[model samples]
Structures are given as structure tokens and as C-alpha cells.
Target: MPEFAPIHLLYLALAIVLEIAANVLMKFSAGFTRKLPAMTAIVCALAAFTALSYAIEGIQLSVAYGIWGGVGLIATAILGITLFGERLRPSGWLGLALILGGVVLLKFS
Candidate 1:
């Protein structure tokens, strides 16, 4: 496997952060009565996807997307567990492990 340039990794990380931010904003906008937040959220989502597309130029789309999604799920789950006091049963842990294992396999395969 080739080592990714630092800049490329930065861009990829930015894309993921933007995507998560957009999703959070979108959820907020749904409960909001004003239009500005909703519109902003839409724009954020568009930008996030655009950034992701740019990152894909330097990385395989399958690898990028699989890592992005898998890591996102894991991170979000951890956040929920720690920040929101959400419970992760043994089955949930098993699922998370499976996802991470799948990602690792994809990275090597």
C-alpha cells in the first residue's frame, strides 16, 4: 500500500468532518422553524459531498467510502456511548467490530 500524502489525508479528514457537521445541522434544521438554518444545512451537505469527491481523485472510491462510512459509524457510536450515555450491548459491540474488521479487510484486499 502506498503511503498517502499528509495533505491528501487532511482533505479526507476534512471531508468526513464536514459530512458529520452537515448531518448534525440537517437534524437541527428539521426542528427549526426558520429557513436560514435549513438552507445553510443544505449548502453544507453539498460542500461536504463536493469535498469528498475531490478527495476521491487521489484515493480509490471504494476504499475511501468504506473507510469513511465505517469510521463514521464507529466514531458516532463511541460519541453516543460517551457523550450521550448511550448503551452498547454485546451485540452492538460485535456489530461495530465487524464493521471495523470489514474496513481493515477492504484496506488490505
Candidate 2:
């Protein structure tokens, strides 16, 4: 793995959290009809992007964004299934596993 500062990792981690929060808020916002959730979603999205920008200063943008997006996508999928009772078929599970593999490869690349 290429070396990266702790602060860069911190920023990337926060970016993933903020992005996940934004997606969850948007889901609860129900097409933005719910005012508070809609506004919070907007804020989270902005913060996520801001953190991503900072992360790229130390971490390569390709690596940072790939990890950020992959992890966020995986977490969101889990939350959707758990909290919203969404279903995933065998194909979906395979896709998630592929994403996990890609993320690990990206980290070591």
C-alpha cells in the first residue's frame, strides 16, 4: 500500500460517513417532501464532497474516491436491507462481493 498521512485517511473516512448519511437522509426525505431530512441531506452531501477534496490532497484521488465510494455503497446496501427490509438476490450478493474485492485491490494498487 502506498503511504498516506493519517489526516488523509481521516478525511476519507469522514467523507464516506457523510455520504452514507446523506443517502440515508435522502431516502427518509421521501422525494424531498420532508423538509428537515431534505435539508440535512443537502448539508451532508456538501460536507462529504468537501472532505473528499481534502482527502485527495494527500491520498491520490483515484484511490481515495474508489475506497470512499465502494465502502459507502456497501454500507448503504446493508442499511437498506436491514432498516428498510429490502431484498437482495444471489446476483446482488455477487455484485457486492465484486465490489469488496475491487476495493481491496484498489487499496493495494
Candidate 3:
């Protein structure tokens, strides 16, 4: 298996973070009922997609997007658990594990 450079991983992680931030901003915009938040959401979405494209330069699109989505889901779940006091049952944990395992496989494949 080929190893990715640190910078490549950094870009990929940044892409994912930006994507998540954009999504969160979009949700906030829904509550504001104003144009400013909506405009900010559009800008953030564009930035996230641009970063994702940059990340694909050094990583396979499939692997990059898979890891991006998988890690994002996991992180969001954790945030929900901590901040929203959401609970995950055994089945949910199993599903999360499967998603993580898929991410590992996609990264190495």
C-alpha cells in the first residue's frame, strides 16, 4: 500500500472539516430567516467544494470522499452525543463500526 504525504492528509481533513462547517452553517441559515446567513452558507459551500477538489488532487476521489463522509458522520455522531445528549444503541454502534471499517478499507484499497 502506498502511504500519503502528511500534507495530502491535511488537505483531505481540511476538506472534510470545511464541508461539515458548511453544512452546519446551512442549518443555521434555515433558522435565521434572513439573507445574510443564506449568503454565508453559499460562500461556505463553495469553499468546501473547492477544498474537496484540492484534496482529490493527491487522493483518489472514492477514497477521499469515503473517508470524508465516514469520518464526518462519526464526528457528528460524537458531537450529538456530547452536545445534544443523544444516545446510541447497540445497533447504532454496530452501524458506526461498519462505516468506520468501510472507511479503512476504502483508504487502503
- Tell me the whole-model lDDT of each prediction, alpha carbons only: 0.76, 0.96, 0.80
- In candidate 2 the C-alpha lDDT for residue 31 amounts to 96
Predicted candidate 1 versus true structure: per-residue lDDT over 26-55, tens digit per residue: 555766565777777778778767877877
How accurate locally is residue 64 in candidate 2, as Cα lDDT from 0 to 100? 94
Worst 10 residues of 3 by lDDT: 19-28
lDDT of 3 by residue, 27-89 (tens): 557775767777787786687678778888888888888998899788777766776588999
Top TM-score prediction, candidate number: 2
Q: In candidate 2, how many Å is residue 58 off?
A: 0.5
How many residue pairs clash per model?
0, 0, 0
Ranking by lDDT: 2, 3, 1
Instruction: Return whichever of 1 and 2 wins on lDDT.
Output: 2
Supply candidate 2's per-residue lDDT for 63: 92
User: Could you tell me which residue pairs clash in candidate 2?
Assistant: none
Q: Root-mean-square deviation of each candidate, in angstroms?
A: 2.6, 0.5, 2.3
Clashing pairs in 1: none
Number of the top lDDT candidate: 2
